[model samples]
Target: MLQLFKKYSVVIRFIAVFLGSYFLLSVLYNAYLIYSENQTEFYPDFFTNIVSRQSAAIMEFLGYSIKLEPHETESAVKVFVEGTFLVRVVEGCNSISVIILFVSFILSFFAKKRATFFYILAGIVFIYTINLIRIALLTIGIYEYPQYSAVMHDIVFPLIIYGTVIILWIFWVRVYSNLEKNESQV
Candidate 1:
């Protein structure tokens, strides 16, 4: 049993660090959600409103007449393009949780302090921008095509986010995190 534990020790440590950081961050995120929910201003989804407004501004920049307004209960924002309601920007669409997950995975990598900090900051900005663009594109796609909305939202756009995270992880493991010398090595 001792020998088996020794053999798989690296794997065990990896799992513990990954899961521990993920859970801790997730708990903090939930606490933030609780606090946000208690607020009267856009209760429960402040970030979602921010994203929605940003997305609407982006669409307007591209010559699309877009209006983003709060929902009746104010739990979300309704995206209107060319005076037609198209999408609802909800809490899940805000990308905060995705950023948290990205940070968790990056934390597990544990590279140089300066490098890690900058990487996380840059990565979060990248993800948030991409999510805003994604929402704008999705709204336009749904408005124009309408039929392929499900495929675009559920499969294609999700792949973009998840795949970007996977790419970031690979880069970290192969390059950034590789600075951490293996204990089994000299």
Candidate 2:
């Protein structure tokens, strides 16, 4: 086992360090929030506040009629508009954000050694923005095309969120790795 890792030391080191850092950071932040809540009811309020505010800002910028307001339910933020669908923002969903963080870190590790942490941080923000857009579109889509709920929620919307992450990963690979440029030179 040691011999195998020695042969792939660089690759293993990149994966271990990047993933380890991402997981620890994400888990710590989320745990802090969860533990800070005074009661179980506070979880949804906290989670939805972040998601709804982010989503609403994007929707407002797009000039949409829909608006998000936080409605305190049993322990969650029920996001709704006067004439639109409702969505409950919760903690587990934001795990997607964590996954994105991990992926960005891993990609950055494979990027140029001189790559700045700020660049990787920007990638994380880009991913989060993409996710916000996805949620906003999903809310509108749910209202506009009620019959497409299964496909939209299960397939299409997830593709948008996860696909954006994939695109970022590829972008990092190309820009940092310079694969195309290297191939051309070869």
Candidate 3:
């Protein structure tokens, strides 16, 4: 037992610390967001406000007669515009964001100490901004292109977001990992 522990102690310790910390932080943050959103009914209100604002702007620009109203559907009260289009906003777990967070954590684990936190922070900001823009664009796309709406919302948008996350992960591995290599050589 002692010999086995000694052989893999460092690996075990690193895994324990990293995985344990990540799980704790993720769970706590998710719980807080869920609690806060539930308390304030923030999802519906926020979705309504954003879609309405953007939809109104788009309609005004295009000279469309669509007036969006918050209508209660079977499950969610969606913003129904012109009695034809409906926009629903729901905020929940963003798996891609969580994946990005974990990837950033793992990449920065092997990076320079001083640069690691900054790299991870930048990744967080990037992921958050992209996610919001994705949602907004998806809403707009659904409203405008009713025919291609299914493809855009279901297939294309998901690919874009997930692909962005994968690309960012690769960038960190290729470029940032090279930085660590260069530093070691110096």
Index of the highest-lDDT prediction: 1
Give one digit per residue, the lDDT tens place, for model 3 in 69-138.
4445422335445566556644332333455455535543556766666766777767655665665566
Query: How much lDDT does each candidate structure score?
Result: 0.84, 0.65, 0.59
The sequence of per-residue lDDT tens digits that candidate 1 reaches over residues 66-177 is 9877777757788889999888888899998899888888887777788889989999998899888888888888988999999999999999888887888888788753
Candidate 3 lDDT: 0.59
lDDT of 2: 0.65
Error of 3 at 71 (Å): 7.7
Q: Rank the candidates by TM-score, best first.
A: 1, 2, 3
What's every prediction's RMSD, in angstroms?
2.3, 4.3, 4.8
Worst 10 residues of 1 by lDDT: 177-186
- Angstrom error of the Cα, residue 114, model 2: value is 5.8
Candidates 2 and 3 compared: the better one by lDDT is 2
Best by TM-score: 1
lDDT of 2 by residue, 35-138 (tens): 64765444453554676677877766777655554455544455565455466656545544555464546544554444545556766677677777777787
TM for every model, in the order presented, reads: 0.89, 0.73, 0.64
Q: What value does the lDDT take at residue 143 in candidate 2?
A: 65
